[model samples]
Target: MTAPSEAARYSIQMLISDWLLIDGTMDNHVWSAVEQPGGDGAADPDIARRPEVARLGLSVRRAGWDQIAGWPHDLEGFTTWPAPGQTARMSLSGAQWSLVVLALRYWADVDERMSDVDGAARSRGIATSVEQRLVSLGWSPATP
Candidate 1:
């Protein structure tokens, strides 16, 4: 099997952030919609234009919760926390599904407990899991 594309790799990195994954199947393209504060519905224009974020092949928009992830759920995506109140929806193409599956596997570890009270513990678990998985995959962190 061939290697996954750069987009898939980047999507994995982006998923580490606190943004809910939005689905844009209707548009035939996946996009990210960030929910900001003070009645703001869109991502900060400046944030949306960031270089690294741009590299993920995503588009940002100002959307309400209903637009991001609500019923009538025909799209496929995941949602994260509410720091920037953004939802990222990167399109799945080629081998990106494997990374998504890995994300699902990771998320499954936390899906059991659905409450913010367990966030700290969950964060630690995710970090531990990722670190262990990475180490097993032959990755070594650089010494500071």
Candidate 2:
């Protein structure tokens, strides 16, 4: 695949940053608020009402692969889906390398937040949400 353009790299970085901030805030605060209220049924409406949570949810839904074009087909075997695990052995332009690194970072951040919420059954929704976002970006756990 062709290397991502400079503008594409910047856009992916911005998206990764936004996703991390929103997801981190949710992990630190909103999930706790939801669990405090008996940890059952749907997520607390009040938690969803928080501006940051609302924005984060919206951003996840809106995320797409438009800026990514296509990921490197020559990636070292998938470590755990979207993340490439290690840098590609083949030559890649700087833009392509940045894209891969940023994507892996994003995956790690989301996975960490998923683990944080794994203890609560109701909180599994957060993992589902992350999975949906990854799917929207054309990633699947089934990817080889």
Candidate 3:
């Protein structure tokens, strides 16, 4: 609950959107994240959450947090990630925000090149690959 100091190497949660996070790497400051939204089946047109695992990218003015009344809010400020604006909220570790962004960028670039399929169908093992890569990069399911 202290102001983030970049030296903490802390694990934190963030809201992410940008549909490209799944099986695609994007251009910008942050590139990838693994998303898992429950009951959000493959049919929905917005994100096609079938993969449940993927890359990341954000369209934020800044990568770090802006505390409002003592809570973190996205740079644009209205909590956009919830409405296809933020596809999911996830937890990951970083000694610095730049490192966090870089980790995601690296993972996204790698994941995008590594996976050939679009939705990570169970048959292709893309989901497994994504999960493994994310874990190797220090990503994990957010603790409830």
Candidate 2 lDDT over 90-132, as tens digits, reads 2223333233333334445655677744333322443455445
Question: Residue 69 lDDT in model 3?
Answer: 25
By TM-score, the candidates rank as: 1, 3, 2
Which number leads on lDDT?
Answer: 2
lDDT for position 92 in model 1: 39
As a whole number from 0 to 100, the lDDT of residue 40 in candidate 1 is 60
Off by over 4 Å in 2: 1-88, 116-144
Better candidate number, 1 or 2, judged by TM-score = 1
Q: Compose the digit string of candidate 1's lDDT tens values, residues 8-85.
A: 221222232432332121111222323333546344465544343333223322222323343323334323233353
Single out the weakest 10-residue window by summed lDDT for candidate 3: 59-68
Candidate 3 similarity to native, TM-score: 0.23
lDDT of 3 by residue, 69-94 (tens): 22234546435433543423333233
Model 3, global lDDT: 0.35
The residue pairs found clashing in candidate 3 are 16-87, 17-87, 21-55, 31-56, 32-55, 32-56, 33-55, 33-56, 81-86
